[model samples]
Target chain A: MQLDNTDRRLLEIIQRQIPLSSRPFADIGVELGIGEGEVLERLRRLQEAKIIRRIGGFFDSRKLGYTGTLCALQVPRDRIEEVAAVINAYSEVSHNYLRTHEYNMWFTILAPSQSEVERVMEEIKARTGIDSVLSLPAERLFKIRVKFNVSEVPDAE
Target chain B: MLSEFEKRVVREIQGDLPLESRPFAAMARRLGVTEGQLLDTVENFLERGLLRRFGAALRHQRVGYGGNALVAWVVPPDEIEPVGNAIAAYPDVTHCYQRATVPGWPYNLYSMVHRHSEAECRELVRRIGEALGIEQYILLFSTAELKRSSMQYFRD
Candidate 1:
């Protein structure tokens, strides 16, 4: 997906905000100097190309009384895929990833309560037959902001 | 406890918004509210700190920034604050947290780093380690992201 300056400008606009109004596209279009229909069409193309993952509201689960934890598991090499499937089955598991380490498989689970998180962990152990599951809940969160720079070239590799 | 209408708002708009001229208006119709009312409700939620942000979480890989790694450093008890602040100051460090360590895994401080390539990710780890003077640390690069979803509250 080769993004033009206008596309980058649109992404920059929406990354921080999207007006909560009857015509948010028109609001953005005005800033980009493009028509509402053009804005809509470009966004649709971005979606089709898998460029824009999501555009919506984000809520704080901790403020809403939810427990989240990052879990790591040492599944046997041959069973990584199989165990990952079992772990991904839980709705609480928001993120599942295969990483490079001894405790290779990692995932984060967000549940309504601590007990629910524990129950899901036990269930995963039981289902996957892997005892090396380690739960590393956040003791403190230092920073949690993520915003990608759109206009400038990305930092060098 | 959240009010019934507030819960409905969270449930309805937490997912993808429609890609149209009047996305919020369409959502307002579905939730039995006018566009102004829906917008005001969202404003209230933001003011109250319930809603984090109403924006797009771009695919980092798709935008040319490619590599990602979760580095856990075993910072000393006396240096946790300084180390965390320093790491979090980096733009590419999206997440920095102090997590409980298990028996064998001694690393306690975690920072998620994103770079343009795998080599750059390694470079970031080295730079952070050198700058922080942390001798013991481990880097875990995600080979695959099986699932990634934003957490939603008050789902109904």
Candidate 2:
């Protein structure tokens, strides 16, 4: 769907935060000079198009008493689909992607505790029979924030 | 301004700060508010859970931490919570989580490790394996970074 100006404005606003006020749509309307109902409708449409994946809280895991790490696993060429399915099933695995690499399947997961993280890895090895796996932990948190530049890039990629 | 309006302004600025020297000032101007007002809203947003943090995004390869990998582990269904908690406690483990395992690829828990050298990253993984008591895992390192952009939830 071609995003109109109002759609773009809504995207710009919602990317930051979904207004938490009772009348969030109304509040957004006030700022963007559009009607509250229009804002709500636009948001619904965006979601329907799958452009806006989810509207949820983004937390600082470090502050929330949870630690995070990025890990990659090298699966045999034929086992990509099987491995991807395994990684995608865990609730902790928020984001998983199939990438071109020696490991081939790259994914990121977030756990509430550290021990859980280790156990998950161990289980993967025993099940997959792929002993060559590397877990890269964050040495320093340089930057962590979502980016929204739909204005610059066309809506449909 | 009403507290809610102030919060809306804060949410907008916190998530979409342009990569500029005077980001606060730029945001204030865009929102048609004073810099002081923007600062106040930012403070409030920080108090709430809406804004996680404000920081820079770096290119790991450019900075020499080019060696990166996504690691996964399979913990028994009952022991997932305990194992995840133990591994996440380590400072080096930046991102960790649990996922469903596919047939032949049964590793479930996953983490991302970034290191200046490949060897260093491998060594850390070895240590994490021993530390977690999970001797088996698959280390999938990136040969190329195709796309690594933070999700733009608000964008259409």
Candidate 3:
């Protein structure tokens, strides 16, 4: 994953904010003094390497009338895979993880309403036979932006 | 607060955006609007704060980031803002939030930290704790990522 200076610059500028234009790559190319084709080729390579997940719109789920909760459960170590499968089956469970704690199985459920999110959580409890979960819905979003500054770090680690 | 047109735009563009010379132009063509009009809609959405960020979200794990943990800390009510800023200053700490506490649970501040390995992750957490000087915390490392998805506001 040794990214050159240009690759680093592309990562930095692309994530800061995408130019809202017809020829957005060309606009980015103008900044880097590279051709639009070069920009596209590098981006494609990044995607192939899974460095860039996707270049697209990021909307506010809450603002769009959706509610979510970060849920934690004390899952049996032996049953992690089986239980995770059942929980992850639900589309509402956007993020599910096996964490290191008494509450080992953690996940996030985002749905159109509170009732919907609760229903899905309850469903997982019944299926996994876990009685309770720390369903901590955000009282207030203190921070959410997660832009990693590629420019600050060097290529070869 | 989304208009029908805005909702339509979101539904159409929430996936992997096309990657061509004129990517936005391609999207604009698909949405049956001129490139300028589409850009205006996006700008308006941004100005109004409907869109949080419009850019490429890199997958850090694939980009050489190792283990990640969700560390929940019990912070005093008075020191939340300063402590939160301190925690968020670390580049490895991607998401930091003040969440609600349960009946017995005391953690109010939560942070998602990434590092090259578990040891590295713990070291960073320890440093953050020493810097802030207020820490009753637990690190919940993610052993597996079961589901990670972008919220589809319109269709969903």
Candidate 4:
């Protein structure tokens, strides 16, 4: 999609850490020499085009006192979708992906406590009937920051 | 004379940041605007620190840096900065931060290491241990990536 100057500006603002204010759009508009209505409109279009997937808080689960673990499951080729469905149904399972590995299905879940973490794993195992699930919890978090460099976008101007 | 139409064009690109080369031009054409205009706004955002960076989300595992682990250290309050900086200086360490530790869990300093093999990752951790002089730590390997999407704050 051809993103004009205004589109690019709006994207850069929305993707980064949003201003912790009541009217973030208005605040962004004031800085960009645009209006709040315009900010809202451009964001709407971005969503329609599937350029921006979702607008929500990237919470620090650990800070929230939640235990997160990344688990991989070796699901049968045919039952991939079924297993994903079962796994996604759990509110605790926040992020799941289809990776290229012997354990093709990789997912992450956040539990309130350690016992809940085990319970979620057992539930997934029982429901999917997959015995080769590997639960790799962070024994150490060496680095954890989500920084996407959007400034590299070519400037056609 | 930027009206709602022009604003809509801008918002579309903001919410939907495409993962492709010439994504801006593609967006401009869809919104029926000149590429110059799109580039101008993007530049403006860049200058204002609104946009951090734009690049490819490479598959770290496929690139042979598959053995990634999160390591946390229990450092005293006064030592957090020194420990974090020491760990961050390592090329193998991709991420480093300090977070509050629970009563039972005293691990506050955290770092992530990416290597081609698990053994390599462990070796890097060992080097970090020697460099930091802190013994208590844990290695939390990611078994799965449950959710890995950029935050969308503009949604209704």
Candidate 1 chain A TM-score vs. reference chain A: 0.94
Error of 3 at B88 (Å): 2.6
Please provide, for model 3 over A58-149, each residue's C-alpha lDDT reduced to its tens digit, 9 standing for 90 to 100. 87788777889999988777988898889888878777877878998888898988998999988988898888689898875666776766
Clashes of each: 0, 71, 0, 61
Candidate 2 lDDT, B1-156, residue by residue in tens: 235565456346425343233446666787788777766665565686545743323234432455576666766768777777777766556667676555456776776777665787889889988887887786767674433434322221
Candidate rank order under TM-score:
1, 3, 2, 4
Residues A64-154 of candidate 4 have per-residue lDDT tens digits of 3567676768988899777888988876775677654566787777776799889999989998788887665664444444433334444
Which parts of model 4 are misplaced by more than 4 Å? A154-157, B1-156
For residues A1-118, what per-residue lDDT tens digits would candidate 2 score against the true structure? 6867777667667666654433456777899997766766776676666576445445455553455556667778788777766766655565565555665666555665689777
Regions more than 4 Å wrong, model 2: B1-45, B48-156
Residues B93-114, model 1: lDDT tens digits: 9999999988987889999998
In order of appearance, the predictions have TM-scores of 0.95, 0.54, 0.93, 0.52
How many backbone clashes are present in model 2?
Answer: 71
- Residues B1-156 of candidate 3 have per-residue lDDT tens digits of 788888888887788888887777778888899889988998987887778878999876765566788999999988988998889878788888889898989999999998877899999999999989976999988877767776666673
lDDT order of candidates, top first: 1, 3, 4, 2
DockQ of each: 0.69, 0.06, 0.67, 0.09
Give the least accurate 10-residue stretch of model 2 chain A, judged by summed lDDT.
A139-148
